[model samples]
Target: MRDPVDKLSAMAIFARVVERGSFSAVAREMQISQPTISKVVKALETELGGKLIARSTRQLSLTDEGLRYYAECRQILAAVDAAEHSFQSGKERIAGHLRIGSSVSFGRLQIAPRLAEFLKRYPDIDIDLQLNDQNQDLIREGLDVTFRIGELNDSGLIARQIGITHRVTVAAPDYLRQHGQPQSPAELSAHNCLQFNLLNSQNLWVFENNNKRHEVRIKGSAQSNNSEAIREMVLGGLGIALSPVWLFSEDLKAGRVTAILSDYVAQSLPIHAVSPANRRQSARVKAFVDYMSQALDAAPELKPVR
Candidate 1:
């Protein structure tokens, strides 16, 4: 090992001497000769061009300059210790705040429930989860990460596909019994289709057949910006809705809602984790996203939304 002869070492030694009120005590603690500790303190005072210590046969006291230098040295030493702790290990490193944005239904039913386990694994991490159906500007909103449905637009943000989600056209048994079930995508035009107002075009529903794409622009009796609201309206026998399968998983299992358009399926979109380009480098954001990905994969209702 090399000798601790640097200026920082000298400053630290001087601070320790001041803290202990004895050069001999600091020398014994550092496993160095008392004369060597005195030499290091003298060198430190010379370099700073200040008289740092007032010494007597009984004890030592810091001069005004020494008091200021000791305070500054404590700050420097604390910063060095913090830097070391931050990179020492994963548990120590991933300690910080994480601001996450996600859609309402997905956040509550998917991400929020699984966060308990994530927090258990990273007790040092604090999560701030904001849920809304509307799109968010990650950088402008000061969000560390966000979950977005569908293909991401080209922008400064970094995006990665985390899972697959698809829409299912469903109606309550009462609603279908009253209005009659639509046999084809085009027939949906004649039905009272509930709309998710958060979508850019609530009237347009796209479908695929024979590897060809087609669209149906239909009217609706009720609409809501929130997925849960639209889901509730559908359950009340108000209208049909194209919704995420997981949102209606319980109803589907109980046979309260019936899925339609078996021949022409609604397209599946990739759910994504979007972050500011700079935030993509953050260990907290990456760890959170990775945990969310695993949790989503294990969700029985989600099932990749195929």
Candidate 2:
């Protein structure tokens, strides 16, 4: 006996729950209580006349029926979004909610600082910035776009290369003083090299010297999934690290860390703005990507090494 409008609202809530994988996340985003979110979804299941979600202590999974309904919900919601957007003028059309994702350090150093200016330009556009060290699935997380670094796998997502992350081999002054500087890429194997574990080739360091490529397998006392953690380890004089120059630009300038093996060039990772292939590119997403592309391109630090 609920109003049709209420049912639509419930459907939207149910879809949000599916996208976020939790009722709490949708509740926070919608500025509602968690119990209210659960109630709406429970009501939805009752109306549908079957169990849609399989709930457990650890995680939520969709039933077969839930999966079908979820697919249909996406199509219906997308159509509604399109219909609403069609009536707006060009500038109005560009205004909406955007969920953006990035790695912890990149989001903190690059994206977070630039958001204020982006917001000022598009006053009506609201953004949710999600930061994590692990790469999140754009479709599963319901993200409009995500900034990624390193070589991408064949994930079937669309990626636009926005910048290059020129890398350098560096170590703290005390560490170099104690362990001696490495003259060549091969010498890296003799030192305690800190590893960034998120990359597939974490222990394998690659370099180029005078058009010759060298790959060195290194071992370390410590390794971390986070770039900032690796930076901290290097700064603590624990070990040498081959990382993006931007990650230690200030430390290098301050002489807290010193660049070594300057004659050998470390492999540079590509910075990409990636989006789900299945999602239609909206004006807001396009605008944010274009803005970030221009912003990141102008940074001399992100430019390819000569």
Candidate 3:
């Protein structure tokens, strides 16, 4: 009888061939001969009693059965790799590819600077960081972790509140002088409001004063999906902007911009380190969350707008 271990090995080789799109490529990656890869795939197909892949001179594609089988193979392979990793590291030291996602501005200003320190602490871990303004589907994208600003609405994932940031109504010193500062939320309608397109209430500026909250619709000539662009425009005196305090802390400190309506500051947005519930026990994900939690806690720039 054919050994089960040998059968699994052949299936793994077949999966690799499909993943690579060519037997030759799989052979090169696995450091085996092309004939060996082809034989393994053929053997796998025979054992399964179905056509797994369609091969032609110019292209290769997976049949419907092959696609389903490939998905299962990937899961099994991942489990096998995780088992080996557990044996190697004893589940203490993190060692694997960790894919993290974050907002462009926050990732560049905050997370990027601290990555070197994290790498030094865990030399075995490999990181892939993606920064974008759009919210990513962590599980769908196979991400290990993500940094989310503002209130999270996705109920499928588990979120850890790492830190909180306040929203500040700010304007360039020149713009404030030219248009006058908004002393109240009502006055915000008169000023040009530089808007972040990603915010849920992009045109609405919310403020709280004397235990009462108000939302005011704002209009401006300028709007941008990228926060950095909006920041630049605000600095150039294009318009007033309601922004996260951390995004403009240095500018505020340097007097490039000044906060307005201090008495009616907006509610705080809690920053979350979110991950799929199943991956909460992953060592690399947990390590990164812990590190970020501590790092963000110490960052004074993220303090409440005062």
On TM-score, the leading prediction is: 2
What is the lDDT of every predicted structure here? 0.80, 0.88, 0.84
- The 10 consecutive residues of candidate 2 with the worst lDDT sum are 83-92
lDDT of 1 by residue, 93-174 (tens): 7667788999988899888888898999988889889887888766445577899886677577788888888678899999
If the candidates were sorted by their TM-score against the true structure, best first, what order would they fall in?
Answer: 2, 3, 1
- Regions more than 4 Å wrong, model 2: 1-4, 56-58, 85-92, 304-306
TM-scores for all candidates: the values are 0.69, 0.90, 0.78
lDDT of 3: 0.84
Candidate 3 lDDT over 121-202, as tens digits, reads: 9898999998988998674455678999888888888889999877788899899779887778998888899889887878
Tell me how candidate 1 scores on lDDT. 0.80
- Model 3: runs farther than 4 Å from truth? 1-78, 87-90, 277-281
Better of 2 and 3 by lDDT: 2
Counting clashing residue pairs in each candidate, in order, gives 0, 0, 0
What's the distance in Å from true for residue 174, model 2?
Answer: 1.8
Superposition error at 90 for model 3 (Å):
5.7
Q: Model 1, 180: alpha-carbon shift in Å?
A: 1.0
- Residue 237, candidate 3: Cα error in Å is 0.3
Report how far off residue 74 is in candidate 2 (Å).
2.1
Model 3, position 246: C-alpha lDDT score: 86
Per-residue lDDT for 1-306 in model 2, tens only? 279778778878888898889989999989999999999888899998998899999899999999999878877766666566665554437677899999999999989989999999998799999999999978668898999999999578989998888998989999999999999989888999999999999999999888999999999899999999999999999999999888888887799999888888898889999987766777888899999999988876665334
